[model samples]
Target chain A: MRGDVIALDVGGTRLKGAVLDERGHALTTLERPTRATRTPAAVVESILGALADLRRRPQAEQAVACGLVVPGIVDSVGGRAVWSENLGWRDVPLRELAARRIGLPVVLGHDVRAGALAESRHGAAAGYRNTMFVPIGTGIAAGMVVDGRLLDGDGLAGELGHVSVGHEELCACGAKGCLEAVASAAAILRRYRSRSGAELGGTQEVVSLAAAGDTVAGAVWTEAIDALAAALAMASSLVAPEVVVIGGGLSLAGATLLEPLQSRLDSRLTFQRSPRLLTAALGDRAGCLGAGLLARSAMAETVGVR
Target chain B: MRGDVIALDVGGTRLKGAVLDERGHALTTLERPTRATRTPAAVVESILGALADLRRRPQAEQAVACGLVVPGIVDSVGGRAVWSENLGWRDVPLRELAARRIGLPVVLGHDVRAGALAESRHGAAAGYRNTMFVPIGTGIAAGMVVDGRLLDGDGLAGELGHVSVGHEELCACGAKGCLEAVASAAAILRRYRSRSGAELGGTQEVVSLAAAGDTVAGAVWTEAIDALAAALAMASSLVAPEVVVIGGGLSLAGATLLEPLQSRLDSRLTFQRSPRLLTAALGDRAGCLGAGLLARSAMAETVGVR
Candidate 1:
């Protein structure tokens, strides 16, 4: 762990952190509640605290860089978190702040984009030159990599959740018929609860109920799968990716989701490339791992690799 | 004109040939019937004849390169025409064939993509790093340029026409509710004719009627504009292009199309970048100018620009 780097994946509810070795393997890991209700200053303090804690550990003593991935529209080139409704941070110069506090070069990226990079480098999409990594969590977004480079588009490129699916239902973002409202984990849970009047524990509970032969749950699950297929098919037509890696809580449904989605996407396509649908291998840790990769990339950039 | 090159834009009904000077100004141009019912080999001969005709002109005496642009899926990397339902060709080694016949380096490309390159170089989308060049003609297709380079996704990318817009009308591609079926010039003209019982000459006639306060034509025009906006908005969300250049026959509407498309796309977007919509600058000759650019690119490559 001599060339270890600190990596942090900050989400709305919790922050995942790791002290990653040069090889990108986590030497140690940590987590803390995001305290999203707190001010941006408080969040910065928490981030610094987490970094300092990692630096003090014996395995992380040689940490030379840091990568911070946040949930928002990040201007990676400008090194600013432009906006994040979930975190209540607007135009925060997080990268510069983190670099100053950590005394190291820092890389800032979006959460879903980081996951895409991690998956491309080490997980389900490894070796694929073109890949689409869709994380269907509380929301849906994609990290699209074309010609071996992950696209950031000034942090506005992967807003797949907001793409209209032509449904009548209104999304939380005030957009009608958005893919997120019909297919995201949050959407699925809310729909099941309202439709069946069942107090489901979570998305996991909804999937369980569907597996146990509940008609409402089954219908809801099928609808989510269909929406995802349509969206993915559109993505395929746009990017022509070799593979599509599905990640997030909903992806845990595994074959139940993949089987239908693959066939539906295939059916939608005429001459476009049919993507290989696969579940993400890195799971929730993908962002943390991607942060590590970003840190390594920063190190290389510092020494003038490009 | 020692650096002059021959550029050809082949369509289903006709093939256009131009002898371009070093600066991409056409020295001489000609158009001949495409003979669509002929075999692919016969089509290649027609292209060769056009090249010969251009080459024999005094202004084209120094032609050293060629660029051939055709409609449909094309693998520019492999120099192969993968499949073109328009030209009735499949897996044709077009580039090699053209080069052999013309005795010059030939660059093969898709028509819409060529138009995109031409627009980016000297037309409406000039100076933009990220752009979507969509031509809504007999069929719809997009030529996407990201990070200053046009994407060649194994010839499968940019099939924007085939994307479902949630209409119930079946498209010719065996898919229900495709954007092309509802928004393309052919689709528009057909819809106008069937609805109004008016045998319109072309999309121009439809637009003229709409401008003259024909309610059916106006409705058809509005539907086309809305569908175009939805698809372009989706393209913007995925690629975050700064500009969207509309080309082909429909672009002749100018402000009539751009005004509605811009506002509708703006309404569809949330946090995504709103693209500037503009009519193409090069008109039908965009393909010829793009071919010139491709020829220049080929010459540079031949001299080892890399």
Candidate 2:
């Protein structure tokens, strides 16, 4: 229980791993290409290799547990990766596999949810009782903490990306007007491309153009912020969280995103108290840190029962 | 602890009370008109008189606790009635006042939420882990239970009436496109009266006309069901509750409301699991039963600590 933990964050394009102390401080980190299209088994092997690499380190060799985080629906209670539409995984017994491969107890959780847990426990929302961690990057998802408990909702909850916000745009989920279709960083870039017929480099390019007084870019950025504000306001009204922590690539816009979002949310909400808006502090390391916390907690529960 | 409990359910037009056994079986029940327009203090006096009438019963003197359920944002944790626009009461320390006058421990809760708690614990939703108690009366509101815990969301969570469903009609809350504007019993009657140019007696009259194949009533009823279906479907997709218990006056429509609602919800939801639809079993006694339960639990908690 006192040793370090190895954590792996499996993303679509990257496999990120870290060896963390009992306090969730990263001792060492590693990254490799996910290569998801090349067999699911190969991706698993790569994750195992990353764990092995961490285990070879002198300090990490004494790690007590391993934590793995994956995108999509995770049946955490059953310790299985239930489904991942992006990874084409269904009913993957990820926890058992990782434990067998690593020769240690393994805990698994949804990536975004794990990241939110990390932020809530050790980062920006450390002292807040009620917090919402929303990662708005390629897609939008929220990890909600209510009364100090992270809400899993039977693995089907936290699909905040699919929540309709009255937009007319078509979403890849086959739903019209999803929050992700308008508010995610990918959505911002797509909106700019659609409006200006210019191939933008990325969301950063649109942010730069908007900052430089480009009307189309500015309009698109404004609309995205407005949509995000409305969605956040609606969530705030429903849950009344103490703080909303914005993470992922989009949050890099910092005050540019936060200022407009705060004003629009304030304007839309009449009855509810405005929640503090802040950027995530852990950045890319959040998921790994969160996974480590999960592993540590799981180990603690096991020891307590014994 | 072996005595009857006094329970009061305050509605817009009427105030109902009952002296109940420890098991929540009514020993005596009474009803009185609520003259809310007279003033807040006068209404409190009237409610006290109703309680006194219940106290006249043989079981009243044996009562150890009193429970009051009112329509409003109740600060359950603080034991205050924050606001009830319909009751015209604001920031009333209802629990403290009732406790001081009744000379017993008093517990207060939102009327619909109390009803839902009662239903979930002792009635229709007894065995279900997740349930949504939606009461479609003069207005629409819901008491949601997830993971066997009733969601109060800081006392403002159950405002299902204000959820926008693209109705494009003005609501009393000054919002356009509210679910209450289209699906509430009052809204149904209003729509029926406007379309037929005849004064409908109540929601029952509109239902009768719709059953008898009246075009105007049919259209109005269908629109109400559609709006309700949309809101329920959205809720289903988000929470995935095991069952949805329909309560309040509109639920008396029975299969007339449920059949079409079920079909529409089935059509709307694709990936989400559809919940079973059922009518509340406890009928009008639900709120009182819930209040009794709250009082009983509060008493137990106090006893446990002592």
Please tell me which predicted candidate would have the highest TM-score against the true structure. 1
User: What lDDT would each prediction earn against the true structure?
Assistant: 0.86, 0.82
Backbone clash pairs for candidate 2 read: none
lDDT of 2 by residue, B103-189 (tens): 888888889888889999988889987788988888888887776777776676667777666657888876666788988988998
Please give the distance, in angstroms, between residue A151's alpha carbon in candidate 2 and its true position after superposition: 1.6
lDDT of 2 by residue, A1-306 (tens): 677899999887788898988777788898988763577777667777787788778768779999899988888878888877667677889888888877888998989889989999989999987788999888888887766777676666567777666778888777776778988888888888888899887788888998999999999898888778766765665556778999999999899889989888776655555788999999988888888988888888888832
Candidate 2: deviation at residue A221, Å? 2.7
Q: State the lDDT of candidate 1 residue by residue for B1-306, as single tens digits.
A: 248889999987888889998788888899989874578878877887887777778987788888999888888888898888777789989899888876778899888888899999899988888888998888999998887877777777798998878888988878887899989999999999889888888888888888999999999999998998888877887889999999888988888889988999999887789999989999889988888888788778778764
Estimate, for each residue in A1-306, the C-alpha lDDT of model 1 and write its tens digit: 237899999987888999998788789999998874578777767877777677677887788888999997998888898888777778988889888877877889889999999999899999998898999988999998887887766677878888777889988887787899999999998999889887776787787888999999999998888888888878888889999999998898888789989999999887789999999999999999998888888778778765
Error (Å) of candidate 1 at residue B186 is 0.8
Steric clash pairs (candidate 1)? none
* TM-score per model over all chains: 0.95, 0.91
